[model samples]
Target: MGEIRQRFTDEFKEQTVRYIQEQTKTIPQIAEELSIPAGTLQRWMSTHRKFENEPLLDREAIRQKDKQIHDQELEIEDLKEEIAILKKAMHIFSKERN
Candidate 1:
């Protein structure tokens, strides 16, 4: 009888790819840890060889990048506000002197 197929998520694949690329252990070791057959992991890596060079971003990495962008935007806004306030204070001081 043929073995039943299993579906893995993009995140899982990404993580697995990342793990494999890390080279901390052999493919068999990682496959054992992930509860997948060694051949299956080998096939996945081979099938996605193109992406191995330019790794597919997993959800967590994308989220962290988004959060970084948001934080930078907030910081820019705060700096702009501080600049505006300084300008106002300078204008007021100049008017009082004049």
Candidate 2:
């Protein structure tokens, strides 16, 4: 008899990580259930964490940036409305004079 080979996909890896994080099961327990070695699973988790890139902007930084952008957009809209009002006033005044 020949040994069978197994293939794991990206989704499988992600699901395993999620299970490890979210479930109360021990690493060995999960490994046994998945038919992987405990050490290999541990290495997989370490690799996943190590490869995760620290975002250039963290969550708080992103929130601040979004707020700044929203404020700038509001200011621009206000300026545009002011310009329209000024143009209307000038048109009315010129019409009165002529």
Candidate 3:
């Protein structure tokens, strides 16, 4: 006789995937703890958590990356302004030196 299979809810699958994401353990380890097939857990993660095979970053992670880029842009602009000021100062000092 074959063993019976169990079904899991969508919410439960999502939470399991999330737990996998937020923890340090391997998929097999988590699956073993939860008594689910590792392949089933991997499929749940890949299907529910990815887009076209690429993992999607969370909204807060995207926001933080955007903020980091914005800060770097501001820093570049500030450096450009400082360089322009320094060039003008050098021009003035060179004229006085002549």
Q: Give me the displacement of residue 50 in model 2, in angstroms.
A: 9.1
Distance (Å) between predicted and true CA of 98, model 3?
Answer: 49
Shift of residue 83 alpha carbon in model 3, Å? 27
| Tens-digit lDDT string for candidate 3 (1-98) | 99999988999887777777777577899889999999999999987773333333578878898999999999999999999999999998889552
Clashes of each: 0, 0, 0
What pairs collide in candidate 3?
none
For candidate 2, give the lDDT. 0.77
Better of 1 and 3 by TM-score: 3
**Could you say which candidate leads in TM-score?**
3
lDDT of each: 0.80, 0.77, 0.83
lDDT by residue (tens digit), candidate 2, 22-59: 65577899889988989878877876543343343357
Tell me each candidate's TM-score: 0.42, 0.42, 0.50
Off by over 4 Å in 2: 50-98
